[model samples]
Target: MSGSGTFAFTVHPRGRLREDLARAWRPLGLVPEAVYDAALRRLPLPPVTMATAQIGGERVGDVVLVPFGARHLLADVVGGRRRVGQAVDRAVALGADVVGLGALTATVTAGGMTLGERTDIGVTNGNAFTAAIVEDQIRLLLDRTAGGGSRPHIAIVGASGSVGSAVTRLLARDPAGARLTLIARTAPRLDALAADVADSVEVAVAHTIDAVADADLVVLLTASADTLLGPQHLAPGAVVLDATQPRNTSPDLRVQRPDVLIVDGGIVSVPSLRLRGGDIGLPDGRSYACFAETAILALTGHRGHFSLGNPTLERIDEIRARARELSHLGFRAAEPTSFGAPIALESRSAVIA
Candidate 1:
């Protein structure tokens, strides 16, 4: 494939209320929430074009709406799979070299693995670059918390996930040596991931978020829509990297805890790419690493399915290497953002203590 390769990333409404606000549904405000929910599913909103961008001939991408919410898909996984497959096929029809899955679409499709197996066109969950960014943020946090020559304890809430597992491997291979607490719902998957890194670094597995209570650094990557982290689960001066869709960090944590810092996961600085139309849910010059992954793959001339299923270290490193070779493209983790703005570290109470 050439550098002019085209990519498309998929998205869905997070919830009915969010969609109502996005479409300015004041006229429909009187309608009951359950009515709106059923109407959305039965109506099957068509694929809407959310955003489109092209940076000369280096890269081209279109973000299209999948019109499905996490709850909708999770409720009917079989139908959700069909919807995802159909959506990718339509994207391929629109000249997409690779189709990227976003939101709950990835979780429902098993990290785009199912679609990759069914479609000839390339498919990606964009986990490779997302994993790289997570590791980069974790490294920065570790450096900030460096003290006493005491090895940092890293707890990953979704250690069995694509992004989590990739970073788990990357961190374990680091010579500085950090103890890892792998927390996830499934014991088998957690054990498997732990075994991969247990020899390289001390590893522990936990099935609850409480396991993070004493961790120096915690990474959240679960698909859970609920806030699982609370005040009791946080350690003083700990760093929380929240990379989940619905956000696993409790809102109360912000109101009550002043010593725990957060580095928003998945957001990356993309200073060069210019958008002429549509909003990508980011301020100018910033985007989610998953969306950036497909764009980078296009720029790097990768023409096959990438970042499907669980990610590997080799894939993460490869994507990062390819990204660096592009001129004027600076891809790195962005600072923690609150309410659409990046917050200064010194200004945050989490860093004061």
Candidate 2:
């Protein structure tokens, strides 16, 4: 497999809706907040190429803006999907080998399948590797904090989703016994996911976050833009692995509950990477797993939609295999980080106290 091709992914506004707008353009700083939001509803800037890097030869990293905030996208999924489809069109025009849905754009498209009709080129939500990273970190957390003999109670908030379901199935297969609780907004979907993993381990399904309070560990994979988890929703000394883009954990939750451990999930670091036009809330070398997925596909000469819909064990394993093949080039998972800071063993172990 030759590593020669162009890769691009869609990006949306990060941080506060109005502030994100002002940061992107200096002129918007003077515009009133009300008028700025009103303009965003009616008029969206066309797919703009914010930053691109030619990482030796044909290996190009292009970051394109879909130009909408998270709340807006969550509110108007149909419109967001259309906007992301347009962004993919821009990527196709640039001769991208693969286009990826970044941030909440994947939520809007339901892991990229909703946009299938809009493009002949492959589209991926990059949930496969995202799931993989979270799974790895959880294993590490459990091994370190619970010792090898204990089966810490684990709850997945978005257990029916691509990332959440993949982790649930993966953990279920592990030899160490751990009681699993699948929490999601949809009861039927939660039941379905529980059924899928029940043979390997015992599973309890719930339709709300209430089921998580008793669990030792919690994983958030909900697609909603809202901050669904807080101190009240979690038991003291609980560990949370959050994989959502805008993040399901509230800043206030972190402030009020120092006893709880909430680690940012699926954040990876890419080697020698230079990206502009967006801030992924990391230093320079790191990125979200979904974006890293597209980059790996491009460099590996992998064509077709690599990761889409709910992630599977096969997809998770495949991405790891690909990453291993190119491990020396350095597109792999980084250390556990909460918010933007690195999480230490002491920091995480305190949650078990």
For 1-353, candidate 1 gives per-residue lDDT tens digits of 24457888887666453543254223545667776577657885667665676654333878776766667887878877877777787787778888888867899999987776655678889899998888888886676555544778889998888878888888888837789999988899889989878789999999999899988888999886567788888888777889877567765676687677766788888776655455555676787888888888877778888888988878888988977876367677777664344655542233322
Candidate 2 residue-pair clash tally: 0
Index of the highest-TM-score prediction = 2
Please report, in order, the local distance difference test score of every candidate based on alpha carbons.
Answer: 0.76, 0.78
Q: Write down the RMSD of all candidates, one decimal each.
A: 3.1, 2.7
Task: Report the CA-based lDDT of candidate 2 relative to the real structure.
Answer: 0.78
Model 1: worst 10 consecutive residues (lDDT sum): 344-353
lDDT of 2 by residue, 151-212 (tens): 68888888888888888888888837788898888778778888878888988888878889
